[model samples]
Target: MGKLIVHPDYQGNGIGTALLKEIEKDNSGLRQELFTSDQSLRNLRLYKRLGFVQFKIKPLSKDLNLVFMEKKPGLLEI
Candidate 1:
């Protein structure tokens, strides 16, 4: 698991892509997972493009939706 944060000024600069690729390359035998709110449509699209798929969706509050996503390199499912 990892957390990546990008400043508004750094958006669309590929920083997040670089970090995600590096982490995926360095980790083996373990699937990666992350969560985001429904509001982050850009992030949601980016994550899906990287092969992460939504496994769960839970409500955290009346105005917020939590989406749990996961990615696996092999046949193993989590």
Candidate 2:
């Protein structure tokens, strides 16, 4: 998972949601994942709102101030 970028002029307009919906439609079983830099709080919140849950948090080894946060679907209860 990597950072997704929307043109500055097109952001805050639900484009991201549309993209995610399309992705889901194309691959229903894919384990969607994303990694957010420490500075991206807004994106992090949006992911949470869309059913993604945090699975890992780690600091960037070279940059103490930078962190890597990953999110994906939770395990199913069998």
Candidate 3:
């Protein structure tokens, strides 16, 4: 999946989590991978909470980097 952003007004309402769960359910048995900015702590936490692990990091500039995360097949509990 690509960027999953919930509107700020609707943030913290489980919208992002539900979308991710649906994606996982649809792609069962396949590894799921995505990337986000290192500066996005909230995104990082959300991804980690959903079973994604950091497997790589790509530097973009002095103050920016891309964090690559992946969830192994069968790791989804919901």
Ten-residue stretch with the least lDDT total in model 3: 69-78
Q: lDDT of each model, Cα atoms only? A: 0.84, 0.64, 0.90
TM-score of each: 0.86, 0.70, 0.91
Task: Work out candidate 3's RMSD over C-alphas.
Answer: 1.6
Using lDDT as the measure, the top candidate is 3
* CA RMSD per model (angstroms): 3.5, 4.6, 1.6
Candidate 1: give its CA RMSD in angstroms. 3.5
**In model 1, what lDDT does residue 58 have?**
94
Q: Residues 1-78, candidate 2: write the lDDT tens digits.
A: 255687889988999877866775676666776667656777777667766667766677655334333334453312
For model 2, the run of ten residues with the poorest summed lDDT: 69-78
Q: Please, what are the lDDT tens digits per residue for candidate 1 over residues 1-78?
A: 556888989989998877877888798657889999999998998888877899999998999998999998763322
Judged by lDDT against the true structure, how good is candidate 1? Answer: 0.84
TM-score of 1: 0.86
TM-score of 2: 0.70
Error of 1 at 30 (Å): 1.6
Ranking the candidates on TM-score from highest down gives 3, 1, 2
Residue ranges of candidate 2 with Cα displaced over 4 Å: 1-3, 61-78
